[model samples]
Target: MDELITVRFFGMVAEKLGKQELVLENPGNSDRLLEHLNENYPDLKEIKFSLAVNKKLCTEPSIIPIGAEVAILPPFSGG
Candidate 1:
């Protein structure tokens, strides 16, 4: 069975992906998720972004449970 993961994009990342939210299947971890995103959304590879899982910011290769909400946040710019 495939797992469902929710991905939310912010700022330029969202713009690049052309959406604020997306649903991905069988995302085992941040690593797999990144690979899937980069494959489907090639532009994602060119940008700098942070990964958040279940509202907590996480480094790559982190575990991603089923139904987890993953966020792609663009680099922050200070005013």
Candidate 2:
């Protein structure tokens, strides 16, 4: 069965995706999710950001759990 993950984007990520959040269907794998994202938004390949699952930063995209909340955080700037 396919699972749906909620992806939340922040800062530039949100701007690039044109939405604050997105619902994606996956098979409970981070790599698969990345593939979906890369396939859907080829432009995202040029941008750098971090993918967090359930508020925790993850290095391997396959760490995301099914039906978990994913957050995309871009580089932050402060003065």
Candidate 3:
């Protein structure tokens, strides 16, 4: 098995995921990671959010090393 990475979700995604953080086997890179997530949580495909790898916003999937910190930020909505 590959190393494990942690993905954090904020706002709506977090609510849907039902947690703030998740530990998953590093799926090679960020793109694969998203695929894993989408497979695990098919609902994510329709959600609008910014993905970050190691605290940096990323549109492309990045390689997730062991213990990497990834985050998902949902579109912000305010009054």
- Best-performing candidate as measured by TM-score: 1
> CA lDDT of 8 in candidate 2?
90
The list of candidate 1 runs beyond 4 A from truth reads none
lDDT of 1 by residue, 6-79 (tens): 89999999887789998878568898888888889999889998999999999656998988899998996878
> Cα RMSD for candidate 2?
2.0
Clashing pairs in 2: 30-61, 30-62
After superposition, the stretches of candidate 2 with alpha carbons farther than 4 Å from their true spots are none
In order, candidate lDDTs are 0.87, 0.80, 0.84
Model 3 per-residue lDDT at 29 = 83
Ranking according to lDDT, highest score first: 1, 3, 2
Query: Which candidate, 1 or 2, has the higher lDDT?
Result: 1
What candidate 3 gets wrong by more than 4 Å, as runs, is none
Q: What is the lDDT of residue 19 in candidate 1?
A: 97
Which model scores highest in lDDT? Answer: 1
Worst 10 residues of 1 by lDDT: 1-10
Model 3 score (lDDT) = 0.84
TM-score of candidate 1 to 2 decimals: 0.89
Q: RMSD of candidate 3 to the true fold?
A: 1.9
Q: Whose lDDT is higher: candidate 1's or candidate 3's?
A: 1
